[model samples]
Target chain A: MKYKDYYEILGVPRDADDDAIKKAYRKLAHKYHPDVSKDPAGEEKFKEIAEAYATLKDADKRAAYDRLGSHSPGQDFQPPPDWGTQYGEQDLRFEDIDLSDLLAGLAGGRQRGAGRRGTMAMPGEDYEVTARISLEDAYAGTLVDLNLSVPEYDANGRLHRVPRVFKARIPKGATHGQRLRLRGKGGKGFHGGRDGDLYLNIELVPHALFRPSGHDLYLDLPLAPWEAALGATVAVPTLAGTVHLKVPAGTAAGSKLRLSGRGLPTPHGKPGDLYAIAQIAVPPKLSEAERELFQKLAAGSTFDPRSHFNSEVKHGD
Target chain B: MATEPVEPAWLNDDARVSLDELAALSGLTDAALRELVDYGVLHPVDAAEAQWTFSARWVVVARTACRLRNDFELDLNALALTLSFLDRIRDLEAQLRSANAQLPRRHY
Candidate 1:
């Protein structure tokens, strides 16, 4: 069997502390993770880091690996004939075991069998939770404290809530349907496996004023009849702030005004536009004085709106 | 420096299409255009039984049909009925446009 050095791969001292090992694993994992890493050897480097982490993450597995001397142990490598009995039949399936099959299973069959530490279980379990943010918060992005209340049994076997607060930095272009993952924060290992990760599903709260239309926002602006007839610049509301919208002279009702770059910034990095459609509002039931003014205006006005109907009837006849 | 506007020879000209051009632009089969005519939404100028011809006005009907199908997820039958209502609205709009052209003169 080839000589595999777990300590050398993790860049840690022979007798490094547990906290130091965990910190090293996180740093190496982030550096080598295929999702974020651009190196040509990213996958291979990630496997090496995971292999080192699997062994060093747990006390018992680390001791067993230390005893084995071969990080990549082969079938030919033999400890004492009665190694299991000597270890008092320690459940190799303990939570800290870093076996490849178990990790692959927990990761939903993405990982292939590679890291083999006897029957030692992998460290950590994976968990899923949701993060709810406002649409505004999602638009601007935010750093928020996510509180997780996990139920566990104490030393006396009494059930209690284990409260944990993690500060998560949401990415700038995080959308409502996207997911974020926190590594090694899930259920504890059985014997000595690494704890799983926590998957965060983001939920965006609905907004009252802003309606999303393919990265663009849409708004219905109610305008007076005169404003629709004679175009007027009106103050309109947008996701960022209020802005004056130019209503072209002779603008009709239902005419849409576009404000470029006022829409949500999509994950693809392109910004959407905001569309404001104008609608004319008519006055309801007039008072006696208001009725007289309209009556006088109608009597004095020579504009007959229905006169075109007379020409159409003559042409049809 | 400000640039002067150019005038075209075809002033007050509207876009027009021959029967073949209409069929090419509309992308509908001959039978489909007949289906639109049968529904009374499209009225093509008829010369003879086999020599019937359509106009570019059918472009609006075809485009509205596409919008109903793709955007609003409406089926062909419902779209045909909606186009009938839209035809009535077009006739009313044409009447209004003609009426706006003639106004009594006023001396100020």
Candidate 2:
């Protein structure tokens, strides 16, 4: 097996004090912590740091590791003849440890195996993963296909990830950040223990036209200048279908028109409302006749759009 | 080859989880979980420690707490406080997201 330099991994000297080792670990831990870090390799780096700290922090493990000699990292080596016997007698067991293959072979040999230590039942580890779905899928239930790489143990008790594929149903009203647990779908158990559960964290993908806020939906409704000036019934799109929205006379931009119970459907209670926000749009280029008509209307009109700004400026002066 | 269609079992807030199951899922020892309870980090279903039952959502809570504890080497009390703060941050972030979703999209 390839040898691992725990000291090198932690960026500490071999003879460093406990305080120094801890300081180095804490700094690295903060930098590589998966929850806080945005780095793509943060999880893997954190795992490596944790493994290094776990071995180096313990005096016995550090001594045992040091006794293996001055081999460089990735060097091919084996534990001394009496190494296992010495550590085995101490009843040291590594629990919930995701170790490298070399360390797993050494630490997990007799203690982790089932038959050699008699039949023992250990519940398999639970797995958590995020599943992203569209807003439409969240509104109306849909089937989603998922390909998972699940870790499994071989006949020789080695860990390897095997590809698993299945289709799951995303229930209606499944909100963002909701966790759906699948029973007995995680890692396989040992010695007849029950398999662990899998937790699917729901993430709703953003929609192009609709913005979802809890159960409510919002849509930007573009209106012509004449449509805003005069009351008009226009078609608005909802998740279910298109419906006609009545804009009141002299409707201004940024006005929100609420359509009751037109948003996402809920299992219980009142369904949410959809809001169509008005945005008055003008033609980019007008023809000669249209320009002449606009010019005549502008010459006749006395409406001041910046009256509020003028009032505020006068009051300030 | 055809893949199997799996029906997912959704766990609600009311779903019960045993102490051992919680420990296995969270990677925290039973003693650490008890300490968490003492520190007000976890609220079990019943008062008795022996037959204590937790909600299935505690699995996520406990796992997150366990990760923070391992990364920071924090004591139980500090860990509990940190977890509470983290929960507040998550809640605020969700609220912000919901509020932002209500705003009209800007097309440049």
Whose TM-score is greatest here?
Answer: 2
| Model 2 fnat value | 0.61
What docking class should model 1 receive? incorrect
Candidate 2 lDDT tens digits, A244-271: 9999999998888999999886544577
Please give the lDDT score at residue A140 for candidate 2: 93
- By DockQ, the best candidate is 2
**Best lDDT among the predictions, by candidate number:** 2
Candidate 1 at B41: error in angstroms?
41
Q: Residue A206, candidate 1: how far off, in angstroms?
A: 1.9
lDDT tens readout by residue for model 1, B32-81: 55676777766766635566655434554564454344423345677678
What is the per-residue lDDT of model 1 for residues A239-299, given as tens digits with 9 covering 90 to 100? 6888998887766666667889887776546677877766667667778987887788789
| Weakest lDDT window of 10 consecutive positions for candidate 1 chain A | A107-116
For residue B99, model 2's alpha carbon misses the true position, in angstroms, by 3.1
TM-score of chain B of each: 0.57, 0.77
